[model samples]
Target: YLDVDLSLDQVHLYLCEYLRMKDLEGPYNAELVPVVTKAHRSDAVPSLTQHELDAILFEVTEANENPEYPAVAVLFQYDAAVAHNALGVTGKAQWGVLAGYDRERQLARIIDANAKAFGRSWSVTCEWLLQAITGYGYIVMRHVGRLLRRQSVRGSASM
Candidate 1:
């Protein structure tokens, strides 16, 4: 539903805002990190290193275990060619990248896993749906209102 293409910084800010709205009591909050590789450079074909994977897996485990933070979601952006080598291989200490419908399915699995690990239900939602429709007009405004109401109800019940 989100139409706007946000830069990484903007996404971080929005994530912070959403976390704030959660009103979770903690010493630390959720953090979003963008990992970029220089594979596009002709000089070097950078791939996700084992150390990097270990660090990311550690972060994911920490995020799940830390009482101060709810969760950490790593968004990886990579070229198809680089991903093919970096992800599809077996016996590698790296997590494979899921794309298209598989990405959505894997995301759901992650949410479910987090829910079990944290003893709570987890869900993902995009903020731009409200941002995009609010200024459009009456029909859009009504739709946004409904969406807001639904979200508020769900949030209230969940938290």
Candidate 2:
């Protein structure tokens, strides 16, 4: 029922703000504790502690279901790690954006099929939610870039 506009940047900002409010730090926070713990506890490259993985899973689940923080799901799902694995970070950002578009189209088809099966209209809000989920990854990165630019400008101005 949220009036979501499917802009990647906006989605990212919403997610960043939501996580900030929740005091969840960011997606990387979950990994940090475990990685550090493993560095000391074992010689193997530190893997996520069960607790860290659980936190990430919980966030992903909440983001997928909650309209208010749709970007969180996207961030966790298509992170830099995934992007790097796919095409390396050289053009990963662009790839992520294009991938989001593809995802949106695919999700739309699925949603449409489900709606038909249930004999319900694919209402505007439902469409919005679908777009939010599918386009979440691109949006989060865009949002982060914008925020960094703003901070840079402010810092320069202050100097």
Task: Give the per-residue Cα lDDT of candidate 2 at 124.
Answer: 24
lDDT of 2 by residue, 1-159 (tens): 112233445544565676578865543221101122332456554233333333333333334454453433223222222322333433221212111222233221112212222222222222333222332222223222122222333323231
The worst-scoring run of ten residues by lDDT in candidate 1 lies at: 136-145
Candidate 1, pairs of clashing residues? none
Best by TM-score: 1
lDDT of 1 by residue, 65-137 (tens): 5435334444322222222223443221112111111223322111221222222332211122112112111
Model 1 bad stretches (over 4 Å): 1-4, 25-27, 32-48, 61-71, 77-159
Model 2 Cα RMSD, 1 decimal? 16.9
Residue 82 lDDT in model 1?
28
lDDT, residue 37, candidate 1: 35
Candidate 2 CA-lDDT value? 0.30
Residue pairs in candidate 2 whose N, alpha carbon or C atoms collide under 3 angstroms:
8-139
